[model samples]
Target: MADGSLARMGPEHREEAWQRLGSDTFDLVVIGGGVVGAGTALDAATRGLRVALVEARDLASGTSSRSSKLFHGGLRYLEQLEFSLVREALRERELMLTKIAPHLVKPVSFLYPLTHRFWERPYTAAGLLLYDTMGGARSVPGQKHLTRAGALRMVPALKRDALIGAIRYYDAQADDARHTLTVARTAAHYGAVVRTSTQVVDFLREADRVSGVRVRDVEDGRETEVNAQAVINCTGVWTDELQRLSGSRGRFRVRASKGVHIVVPRDRIVAETGLILRTEKSVLFVIPWRNHWIVGTTDTDWNLDLAHPAATRSDIDYLLEHVNQVLATPLTHDDIEGVYAGLRPLLAGESEETSKLSREHAVARVAPGLVAIAGGKYTTYRVMAADAVDAAAVDLSGRLQPSITDRVPLLGADGYYALVNQTDQLASRYGLHPYRVRHLLDRYGSLVHDVLAMAEGRPELLRPLPAAPDYLRVEVVYAASHEGALHLEDVLTRRTRISIEYPHRGVDCAEAAARLMGEVLGWDDATIAHEVEVYQARVQAERESQDQPDDQAADASRAAAPEARPNVSEPVR
Candidate 1:
């Protein structure tokens, strides 16, 4: 691995990456830029292998950005008697909290209310006890039993009759998109050629075995061949499609399960800790976001569009109905700030229900030089990546090194705690509030200086955005300049999350953000205006789709919006 390689992913860097992709024959080429894909690239690159990571869209543009944003062992999985999966996930959570990404991953407490008169507390406590001890390393506190009054005191928004008792447990949470992007950047730092808006059109073959891939630049329709010894398919929901494109029969099938989530104002839910409620189908979580509460998620089969999964009116109503059961004041449609839907790539089983499908990942050598991995939780992405690289080792000729990513911290993780201790000094130096400095540190860690450095001469860039005051104007510039944001949606939705956290859903700041991005990307006036119009249309389409009654209608409405990446097309069948 190249020590201290440049991690900047700006436009100039992207051009270099494209040139490298066309000329170099890599040891491994990882497809998909989601968390697992990014993790796979990091794993391969750190092993001193020549690696290249290509994505059709921006990093975490799909399911990775739309997760529940937690790094916990699945409590429900414990009930399902999947102790191994839960234990593995818990170990990964501990790694993320203490070793991997302390800046991005943080401890979050959740209250599980009890409705039954007896047996519920002990039954739940037994599970929590196992959960706390399974990981071997203890970072967060264990579960605490509480009476209904104590629970109500902890969560004043809960109704008096909602729970007889409660059990509060600790878990870790982070911005999934930012975390994924950091993994990709860390891979790039280790000499991995990372490029987005580059789509794989077909598999390149030598004799009967898979050799490499033919990729197209989605922005301009330029095609090139990326030769590699082995290619790993890490596409989550699109796993099956890519496998089919390779002309290889996948050993396992990936089924798409739609999970919908709604974002509401934090004040609407008066809770010190997040809430986890029991639903008829699965568990419901009211997760605590920065200034909002994220409540979701219904597990239903989805066979429609994979790129943009639409959340129908029924899906939103389902979440509101379940969450309102425990809230003192019921939430209505008007209370919602934003809505998003993502598809889970589940390993298909005999059971028809998507919830019943396995959460454990499966890796198989689909072809001589091609490996496919799918059906795993976000917490266990590193493990999945390591396993995938291990499977690809057969295709590689030389003696390969073992995975050392567990010991390797992400790019910004170093000196984060020290930075937190010096927040006041940092705020003073930057001429900003300590709170804003703290926010920047959490998002950028030691690299916060890299972000602040962009405003050396441009002082106005440090100021807060007019429409979304929570995010600074400099963040929009940083997204385009360093975060591999090829389009305006990549900035608003994944890089800054202005698309979901605010009431206007980033519409009010579209023009401002587009112009800021244009300055870095060298967009003309017409290009800036087109970007704003496209982003606004996307927001409007999402709103319209959310109002639709069913998935079919919702998919049609959402698909009507123009794609930001003009040349992106479906995979070749």
Candidate 2:
């Protein structure tokens, strides 16, 4: 298949992919569609190796989509004296900001409030200074100190006695789900067969060596054997399970750590910049999303239901309690628009706290032809990918080329800045506001033209969704036709984030969005209704789960919802 044809992940492309999966022998098979798996596929494909990336559900349906959404060096890690990890992440952050994903990732400022008067200021300033210089390339502004009055003026939402002063620093943020999807698409563009709703059932072994994978189409239950020289397991939280399934003892264990975030209206917090407050266990961030303020997150050990990590009422209360300490007008549960919980696949350590576990990733050649990678932060997925592929090179024939992914730009990255300059022209051409054009550019980057082209004959698609005005109807169509969103929840929750961005949590727009997707995927009225029903039920289950008191109750509540991909089996223990 031509590279361009492979890049489009519509229904037609997915059908072609299934055929290819059954027939073609690839150099590498990536099991997981999170950022790391996608990045690994892209890296290997660019090195002129045939690759296939498979996911059990939608891309980024795991921890990749549920992160803090920042491309930052761990400022707190410096406090832990994890200087090398901090430096590496900062370098990756700079790459995303300037060279790699200029459109998807942009600079976001944060204010670190100083509670103690004298000692806190200089102490933070020193940390900030190290943060500013460590990344090497200065794409963002350096840190600046602010007085109590200055900080209050910048963020009037803060109480008068919340802080003595503040330090403002810059970090970058992106829509995590969109970024991960783009990475997968970029991999496809480079000739990797990227397919979601495809689960790896077992390993393919020849004698004592691993050879390939036996995969099942979670959507339809059709089974296929994909021949590959090496299989890299990038299944974040499910890492150990996959290792065990292969009957290979893993070099390290991965512990699940749950992190929760809540979204509120942007107007609720009168802040010009994001706020970072210290907690006894971890830090809480009040981040400025496009139309909302994203406040999170609690780091706690999670031992139940890794796939559906639930956020309980106690979790919500913990966030509200801490954030309210500094806010002039305290927020209640009623003010929350949405809440989400994700599990971090921490490399388990001697420390009892999940937060203290190592953020550095580990790549192991478990057998002759299989490699497993886990325990890395979202910001450093690319680096983690390179390392995994390098480790798997031992199984491949011939001399493999060194990874050149650092120099490879993702799809839509090439002309992003040029499109930014032509936003007004694009708006005029599309009969849209310049602001809407800019928003589309940030989300789709240089591919905004392709997105707008879909609405050419269909004028109605140009209009915004009535229930979720932030996104245009064309985007829902594009998600199915180009981005490989198979189900309604994939479009609503991951593709556009209408689920967490709106108070209705995408329930109100479910039908409209489903209809838009149905147009692209050829969904009948029955399929559309079924999709809508499942999405609504999922939302209700999440709401019920959030109201529960603890993780076990929350897990039970969340498990009540019908599975979007019912055929996808749970990980084998």
Candidate 3:
């Protein structure tokens, strides 16, 4: 509540975390700091139980951050008649929009281009009517069937012959990495011991149950024993590897499917409405990201490095060719500003294909004290966490209560709606323009006051980073001081999004950002150099990898960056 500065998780916070979790005992230990894991920790902590959350890398560094950034009920799933998944996701969307994260998540509209005139309109309209009825979808207007003229009017960027008609509908979107970070920050606010860059190397077993995890501080390389009544694994794509860490065969295996997205300047695609163009393999989306468009996602089987999934030349070309079919101006390789790839964990079935697998998650009790959850979508993470907790509570050995997170608001949600009205006052107080203050409000809600207050002594901090003009210098400092951004990549890639937003991919600003962050993290000259070197190599690898023709070539190109200390971060399952 006190500005939510991550400074609380420093040496003192670390000392306190260890005193409780480091003391070899807790009521619950939740592994992995992705959204689901963060949610599980919060659910367990808020229910009057002691909890500890451990992440081998920065929080949300996996699929949670590198997502399509939507919070909508899966519309395509509706086509598949996955009514339950859509309804559940719609309910969560309502909570995030009106109750949970009003400041972070907002409504966004998409245009479904009708390739055929008559049948496509009615068929889509019938499905949308059902979509509108699913849950608490009242905040948005119902879908509207539109004429080709109406559709073209809504999306002026489209060529004349691109569509027969269109159906415009609404969905919600969020800054995924920031939302996940807020979840962890909110968990800590509720007294959960939260630590990142801490590895869960092994499970602590008693008789037949998992009692806790033997964790190693990847930063300091110190081993510590954390005892807990129950352990829940929310490692997503890395489920099988974590199960192996326990030396137990999992109830099922998790198959990794790779999806890649490219970011381009929004001006290249002139459209009033976001476009969802159907492709032979899947749907192609030209969704609006801040000052840019996010064109993505090629789904395919991946058996390579989970930590850094590389996108090859063919994948990029496929996206360009498909998206260019309707574009008035075509986007080329040079048009791309940022590119990212993520892996989804699908429960392996008899079908060896990853795309054919379902997104429904699995909860398994491999050991008496351990429960593992994997293979769910971003919107239903709360459900996955609740289910994981429900499964592990069997071993909790107490009169337990059902999950209350359904009715509970995340930390900023309580007063977020009211704060939206006070943007002018907040702007004046921070000595920034109302629009700038509004941007911060949308990003951090009441937490903007914390970021602003941190900059009170240095008014110069209100200005933008020279290299990454989209972010303030204070944001870099805040990432280190309050948002658990211990490393340069954490600040650029996750905390601030400078890595993908900038043309140089944050390589140019590495030193300047590092110098600013040094004030908070106490980094010396050598450490700064090391961080810069590592980050530069990473950018080089990613750039070189993107030029390769195949996944294997791309992956090899991306691996030139020297590995950090072994076991510094968990290879996302």
Candidate 4:
């Protein structure tokens, strides 16, 4: 199992990675730790190449983490006649659900509300039938049509006027943050040296070609140069800034689209299935989260603060006003439990509207040794990663192997299905409730045993946190031990949903999370204090910013908080 096992994933073991990164040149050095970067690192490493993945923050701390959390085939893409895109996404979705990450990805059903009695049902069903046929994968049930009474049964919160009928279709869902971490850890498992909180300060050039990156470890003040034969730039929205640092004119501009989502308690709108509604700009989703519903998403262009996109009051109002139209009992500001905003990296075009620009990705050879990839959806990240690596591989003269990631399965995926069947026995063994065991199975799958191992020694790790009762203390501790959770915010916001699940927004539990993380990171009292302060300030800033009127006020309010990109923008010396 030591041939790349979970035991090796603990960041504490590689705490001094910066010291070793400069000691060698890698075959490939990935510039971002989001899904695409992590996937590229894994793909390259698994194909017998030495790789290093660096990120300024924890994995998926951006759009990868703040997604709709659905492995959907973009039902709207059907209407646009992007059948190729839909087919590709559905194939990837099937791979994720069936083979690649059976542990992390599970199917979820959504009710497509049919406003018109006769026309919409048949039309939507025809689209879904095409979707089911396109994938040629049967990991989930096919679409089915239902009458008004059946639709009401699925979504009782919807008003009688909201729909005359509905079509039920399945899409896979995942814990976005956890899945990203799993991808990175899987990359590590394949001999890729992946490190987070390591920012690429500047590019290392050899003659006219960009050779590698000069990176700084954020944990300490040390700097390291990661040399690579070819560098694949998968930095997402920061594509232009990173390429310009190499003094090469970027081929395409990446425009940022700000999408905001709100989380509310499940009781606020009791729905048997997730609801998808047609919006003016884009589609709206009311997803069923753990005891809560994730209602969101306003699509608008954002030009400022790519790191911390704020949810302005107008954005919140737009979402509420749209969603409340269908709800029998409208969800007001008081009903909201949490709010999050993320920027979609869209390819810039003649129009200023971010929603209209292509979600398709672009790859360019900025210099002799660098390939920059930008503007792609999370679901389509694998193809983008494969393409970026393939393009960069052209710079290498050797016979490189073709991409095999389509057949790759992530960690925790090997024995997942069987584990689901034995959930009762596993629960008895762990001394947890049946439902709690099922929850763990859904979250951790076969690796539930790995999670329970900590509790075997401590016994008390089985207990739940005080402020956030949904997660166990072991999960918070394990986040640091396995997942590279550097700060309290990573544990609260990403590792767990406490940041958005609890009404307090992880404020009351910040200190507790800090104390748990301190043990793993060897943090002193001052360090713990600083982590808690930064996390609290972030939550406060997000809340305050969300109350503001427009994007400008929201940006100003969010600026009051600590920045993710601390000091990379200064002219490179």
| Candidate 2 accuracy as TM-score | 0.99
Indicate the residue-level lDDT of 527 in model 2. 97
- Which sections of candidate 2 miss by over 4 Å? 1-6
Instruction: Single out the weakest 10-residue window by summed lDDT for candidate 2.
Output: 1-10
For candidate 2, write residues 33-54 as lDDT tens digits.
Answer: 9999999999999999999999
10 residues in a row with least lDDT, candidate 4: 1-10
Model 4 lDDT, residue 433, Cα: 82
TM-score of each: 0.99, 0.99, 0.97, 0.96
lDDT of each: 0.93, 0.92, 0.84, 0.83
RMSD of each: 1.4, 1.5, 1.8, 2.0
lDDT of 4 by residue, 1-573 (tens): 112244345665566566568987788889888898998988887778888899887789888888888888888888878788788888889889888988788888889888876677778778888988997338788887888899998889999988888888889888888888888888888778888888888888889888889998876667878888889888887887787777888889988888889999999998888989998888899988879888878888887888788899989899899999999999999988999988888899897777677777899887899989998788877888888888888777587888898888887777778887888898788888888888877777666777788677787889888788888899888888877787788889998989888879999988988898898888899989988888888989998998999899999999899844354343332
Estimate the lDDT of model 3: 0.84
Please provide, for model 3 over 395-512, each residue's C-alpha lDDT reduced to its tens digit, 9 standing for 90 to 100.
Answer: 8867778888777666556666667798788777777788887778788887777777878889888998888878889988877877878888888889888878878999989998
Decreasing lDDT order of the candidates: 1, 2, 3, 4
Clashes of 1: 0
